[model samples]
Target: MDEERPPVVLVPRGGAWGEAVAAAARQRGLDPVVVPLIADAPPEDPAALDAALARLAAGHEDSAEDADEDGVPDGRHGAPPTGRTRPDAAGPGAPWLVVTSATAVRVVAGRVPRLPAGVRVACVGAATARAARQAGWPVDLVPDDESAAGVAAALPSDAGPVLFPRSEIAATTLVDGLRARGIAVSEVVAYRTVGTGDEPVVLAPPPDAVLVTSGSVAQQVVRRMTPLDPRTHVACIGPSTADAARAAGLPVHVVARSRSAEALLDAVVETLHPNPRTGRSS
Candidate 1:
């Protein structure tokens, strides 16, 4: 009998997202070891976040009342107390709630269970959009590019104020891009990405590939697991993350076509198994 192969992939992430990646790896016939390099925590200052949620909730309530008085039946529930806010008076149009990560979805859903009626939600990628839908929040837009600029491009030019809940160290691409387009945006730090200090354990045989999901994770991988072996492939989730890996002097073997768990796994498999016909990995 052949000796069982050692785990081939190392997932340096945490929580549900990490689990999802590991599971996908298993489906692809690769054993995965999860060693989270970073953890997410609520923002140090949640006052601003709370205040913004409150304002949105209040605005929703006002709109719900107006809709009732005008004999307009609530679409979700046709009744006097719609139990939902109306979107028309919120701004020039429904305020766009842009969520860039699953963490943002958790933060917003936990704080405000019910969003104001007519609030449009734009997610950065398919993963973030799925999280929003799972949290019972309707998603209006998901960009094909799966990046900050993608979210901005997907939004309407005359869109109302955008509420962006993101990580503390999030890049200004989306926020800056929207503002340059003459759109008012209120950005709040919903969470902070902090190092867990739990370094990846050195196995008898090192993992064949190490997954880097974010720029922060890339920094931690460099700090904790420096001097990585040349053979160890560094697979990044997207271009931004690949740039971070390159900036840290880590060799990037592959980058996912999209910023989803499945895509990440596909990138890894393609790197390990190049297609003979095209001389390229999927």
Candidate 2:
């Protein structure tokens, strides 16, 4: 009899990626186990964020408006009254979203009473767009090249004043690139990524494959790989994540497209099945 096949393992580095991995695993007929390496929490100081939220709520939080009123570009403004809220379309018009993570979508949905119906959502990856869509908002652009830089470059010229509400620790490369390209952005810190700081989960041994999502996840996986098998296959979402995995000295067997669950599953199928053209074809 053939040896029992080793189970494919999934490590959803964080809550946002967990949602994607879980959905993708179900689609591919695999059982995914979530080893949450990190927790997403609010900022360390709630007072500053609370004050900002109050300003945005009070109708005077427009970055552009503040800039115009001050003549000087960068001085801080006094916080607006508490419990103030802005209209959904506060900017020039309905803005297109520039979302990089699923958490960003949920954060915005939670804070904004109701999203602007006419606003368009643009996501770096399919999973992020899916989350926004599930929340009943219109997702207009899901770029094939999934990254902050990619989405920034792919944005339509007509998309006025793009809104990017993302994690405080997220890379600023995308924002810088968009700004260099002359895209007006009103960015807000919607959430923060916190290291769980929990003792690493003990593993019996690494399975046949390990799925990795973000840089933080890669680092967490490396830290927790003490009981891991040396021969485990490593799969990463994209070039950035693949780089992280390589930095951990693991042989990366998969480099998924666009850092989405669909792409990761496709990469896994291709790795295990080995048909370049049609991964599942025997």
Candidate 3:
């Protein structure tokens, strides 16, 4: 009998996102091994994050305090969020909370459940939006293009200052882009990325495909699992990650059209099967 196909593994660390990736791989008949190459760590200095969150929480409370007995908020509820604090606003001035990743949504929501009145939310993509919704946040903006540049381009230039909570190694694309547009962005480190520090992974049957989700994960993969089989396909979630993989001296087999697990797996499936209706090549 022919040898069984090797399993695929990905992400290194994604939490909920990782689970979604694994499920997608399974649907494609790619049993992926989940070996977290890195883990989430609290920032060494969380004072900045704490302060920002406190202000947001206060604003959330103040907004609630404005509601009448009929539950009609005297704030931006029935009305659209102006992205600026109204003179009679119940809460403190609100800022636009920008989230680019599902992880960011999880982290921020853990602190502030629902956003304060007048504080609009902008997520980069559908997955992140879903996460924010699950966390009880009202996502006000999701760019048609699901990338950092996309978010920066989509946000209104005349809007209020933006409160951006992100990972330690987050790229400067959004911040830089917004800044160049003369928009005020207050970036806070919500979490840190630390190596899981486990010894190099050893697999009897190496993964046929590897999913690279983030730049950090790409680095870890290179460090822990170098000397990959030439036949092993490396799939990146987006162009930025593909750039990182190439920088790390790892050959990238494919870059997903969009930034999602299903997209990544779809690209891999396409590579694996040239024929759409049939698994075999046409």
Candidate 4:
């Protein structure tokens, strides 16, 4: 008789993201049990966000120029004297819209039907970039690193004032980095992360592994689901989240190489099944 496969507990954000993780778990030969740890809702006060969006739109209207037939800047149509194209098409005055998460993109799109023209959109990772593109915004930059610090470093020195819309519990990484570089930053609380207040449902058989995707999720797990089994593996999505898990007294067994769902799943797989000969995941 075949041995029963151990189940993997996934603490994911509800909706499409959660469904995707369930599908990925099946492909990896792990039985998935979803326990949504946190939920997001728009911020209570919309006045500040509304005002910021208005200012950004107004700035664009005041400075934007018409693109040529080829969709290039009018004056700089051909290659320059050095045979190189200009780095940025938006003028220095255009506001830089930096989105670090898909949730942030959704919140911003709900308030502003269309993004202001000429505003440059920068995302922290491929997932956030896809969200912005789907919402009819053109992405200008995606840093090689998925963290806030990485995004800050990738931005041009002369990029204009940044408008960052994020969750209320967001870390200070981006804000601090941008301000240190002398760039003006205006932060809008786009959403709030709230706990469900319901206790986590106990699995018939405890999970073999538990995945932590965010710092808020880590906090909720520690608060709601205390006394985790020692044998269960705790996997984090990245370094910052791993730090949160450790701070909450969770024993982290794996950390993803990148901030993508695929990389995170890879970490879980390696933690659960190391290669026999090399004693490392293949």
Candidate 5:
């Protein structure tokens, strides 16, 4: 009798995020099959984004000023940047910068190495938080709840102003939630999420589970691959992704408690590991 293979998981992501997910799956004793279904592109029109960043860098007549006594930039290095290294980022008048995705982090950091002085930073989830740290930025806030409502509820009610750099098609939950709380929000499109069309979701070796990272991924998974195996569990990263999966007509088997990779895997392990499969080859 041959040894049975471990359960397999299909991850619809590429690049570093995909690699990380694969590693996580391996550690969890599952086989990870990666398929790059989506890609990122710069926004078609960057005028609004440029203007907002320009304003953020304004009032900084002296760019030679050093970082604060603690060595953190005005916007703070432990979070997100406004772009170029401007000490004013830590200044009292700075806005609180909010980054919801890793792509947004890369876009903003490329322009404003440091956010205009005095700007604080908030990340939506652990993955995004890691990206912020990788950019050499300071992080002041990371909500316990990774959802927009969670972020809004966790933010300081008295937060003066917030600078939100997000994807072109990003949902307005965060903006709406913050505005409803009486906080001023400046929203800008940082990038566009595009379809890769790399390969139309072919499952050579049928997976026991599929991990959906975002609403876009959910849509793509359903569009490219449908009539999934009844035994295949579709795990969504969070409530929003789960909703998207269901709306796209894909049955959602599990929903992670939060929007992080760890949470997603936790749901997978708890749901699928009880009874492992034996070589689910399509």
Candidate 6:
């Protein structure tokens, strides 16, 4: 008898990777099981975030500021103030907003109550885009790159100077790219990402493939699941993620073109299907 399809496991900790994986598996007639290994929450340190928001609102920087140097905020200030404190008045909607993460969406919404109706929004992935929509901002663009560079490339030509509230560890590529295109951009630290929990999650026999998107997620995975199953392959969502996976001592079987779950699934399918036309493996 022909063998049954092996169960495919989705390990999206939060946001939308798990759902994307499940959707892809279903499209391919594969049985998918969602096994969340981690989750995301607001930063535990409120005081730190409060301070960061204050700095962003005031446009005050102790050190010389550049977009590239903008990393995850330590949030030493208080919560984002309501009205006029926001940089530049775009007539209740002057600035276009570009956010790359789900957390950033929450930060922008909580801090800026009047997000200016004319301020359009753009993000890196479906999850971030969805988060923006939920925050009552109209999403203008969703990048195909999934990286900072991708988001930068996907920006609409008419998007005005953009306000980016993201992690302290965020890449400067987006900021630099936007600046090169003559788009004014602000890099604000909405929150900081520190390793929160620790405890290796051991699987029964290792999954067929493990998908990793962020450096922190990779670090956590390594710290938690170090003695990885020899048989399981690792698939990174993009170049950055692959770099992290390699650093963690895991061989990356595939690297998705963009940092999206759809790309990851495509990578997996290509790896598994090989070349049916050639009657040989890829």
**The candidate that achieves the highest TM-score relative to the unseen native structure:** 4
Alpha-carbon RMSD to native, per candidate:
6.5, 7.9, 5.3, 5.1, 6.6, 9.7
Give the TM-score of each candidate: 0.83, 0.73, 0.82, 0.85, 0.82, 0.65
Per-residue alpha-carbon lDDT of candidate 1 for residues 1-282, written as tens digits (9 for 90 to 100): 112463378898878878888888877766689988889898999999998777666544544554445444333221233334334332223457899988899989998887776677899999899999999988878888899998888786645557898899999999998988777788888999999886556644667789888899889888888778666789999999999889987889989999987898888877776334432322
Kindly list the per-residue Cα lDDT of model 5 for residues 27-89, writing each as its tens digit: 777789988778888888788888777755552322224345643335432233333333333
Ranking by TM-score: 4, 1, 3, 5, 2, 6
| lDDT, residue 57, candidate 1 | 62
Reference-based lDDT, residue 183, model 1: 73
Clashing residue pair totals per candidate (backbone < 3 A): 2, 3, 1, 0, 32, 14
Candidate 6 positional error at 195, Å: 4.7
The TM-score between candidate 1 and the true structure equals: 0.83
Inter-residue clash pairs, candidate 2? 57-84, 57-85, 58-84
lDDT of each: 0.77, 0.63, 0.75, 0.76, 0.76, 0.62
Candidate 1 residue runs with Cα over 4 Å from true position: 1-7, 59-92, 198-201, 274-282
lDDT tens per residue, model 2, 1-282: 012332456665645557766767655644466777766787566465444445434432344444334222132333332232223332232245678888877777776656544455788787888888887777777777788778878875433456677788677867887778766666667788766665766655445567877776677777766446665668898887787778866668889866776788777766666333332223
Could you tell me the TM-score of candidate 4? 0.85
Backbone steric clashes in candidate 3, count: 1
Candidate 4, residue 234: CA error in Å?
1.2
Give the per-residue lDDT digits (tens) of candidate 6, residues 1-282. 113344354454644646766877666544455655555545556556565445444433321121123332222222122233122222122345678887788876786764554455678887678777887777767877677788887774434346777777776888999888766677766666665467667766456667776776677667777677765667788897788778877778888876666767667667656344432223
Off by over 4 Å in 2: 13-31, 45-94, 226-228, 247-250, 274-282
- Record all residue pairs in model 1 with backbone atoms less than 3 Å apart, i.e. clashing: 60-85, 85-117
What lDDT would candidate 2 get against the real structure? Answer: 0.63
Lowest lDDT 10-residue stretch of candidate 6: 63-72
10 residues in a row with least lDDT, candidate 2:
70-79
